[model samples]
Target: MKFRMAKKSDLKEIVRLLADDELGSKREKYEDPLPEAYYNAFSAIENQGGNQILLVIKDEIIIGCLQLTIIPGLARLGIKRAQIEGVRVDQNYRGQKIGEALFREAITIAKSEGCGLVQLTTDKERKDVFRFYEKLGFTSTHEGMKLILN
Candidate 1:
């Protein structure tokens, strides 16, 4: 698998991967005339300095993707941390350790960026994902809460 930054052209495939699962099927709209919101959001991220959308390509096709945002804060001794989100692997590529490789590459990138910590939040209902993250050395030391503005 090859790891690289995502491009605008990769959006369709990325959306397909994201919408392949049950949760994403309800949340993501994968249809003809792809939504403008997706492109707008991608452009925003592209213009942001400390944010990135990464892609994992296999055999010249995108198979997985994730978003990473490096946040600078006064806490933790003014260190920067990387927040990972939107992690997804192609349904056809699940159980192939691609997710593991993706995480490892993300960590490496975070470290290179001088991130003191790498953190992410998964849906509480995803028990299996929790285990997967734990196995990857993440700890559930604090509760995560979110409110949708829209």
Candidate 2:
């Protein structure tokens, strides 16, 4: 598998991956336009120097995608932190460690970009997934809540 920065052209495949429930359920109204928004958001992020979107390809097919966003702040450590979002691996490719590989690559990218820490949020009900992230070196450090616009 090869990993590279995502381009606008990869939106369709990325959306398909994100649409898969194995990945996670998407936001209601935004679900239909997610592909376009993902591309636009990624473009905006890269342009702003706070985001990096990557795609994992195998056999010329996009198997996974992730967005890493850097948060600049004046905190205890002077290091910028990264937030991982829109992470999804194709259903057919699930058990192959592609997700882990993608995450590892994202972390490498974050570190190279000078981010002090990396973070991501998964649904609390996903117990197995929480374990997986912990195994990959992420800690449960904070609580998160969201009120999606209806």
Please count the clashing residue pairs in each candidate, in the order shown: 0, 0
For each candidate, give its TM-score against the true structure: 0.98, 0.85
Write model 2 residue lDDT over 1-150, tens digit each, in one string.
Answer: 999988777766776777776335454223555645566665786697767678999999999998888888788567788899878888899889999999999999889888889989887666777877898999998999989885
Superposed model 2: Cα runs more than 4 Å off: 22-39
User: What does the lDDT read for residue 97 in candidate 2?
Assistant: 95
Model 1 lDDT tens row, 1-150: 899999999989888988988899999999877899999999999999989988999999999999999999999799999999999999889999999999999999999999999999998776789888998999998898999999
Candidate 2 minimal-lDDT segment of 10 residues:
22-31
RMSD (CA, angstroms), candidate 2: 2.7
The superposed Cα distance between candidate 1 and the true structure at residue 6, in angstroms, equals 0.3
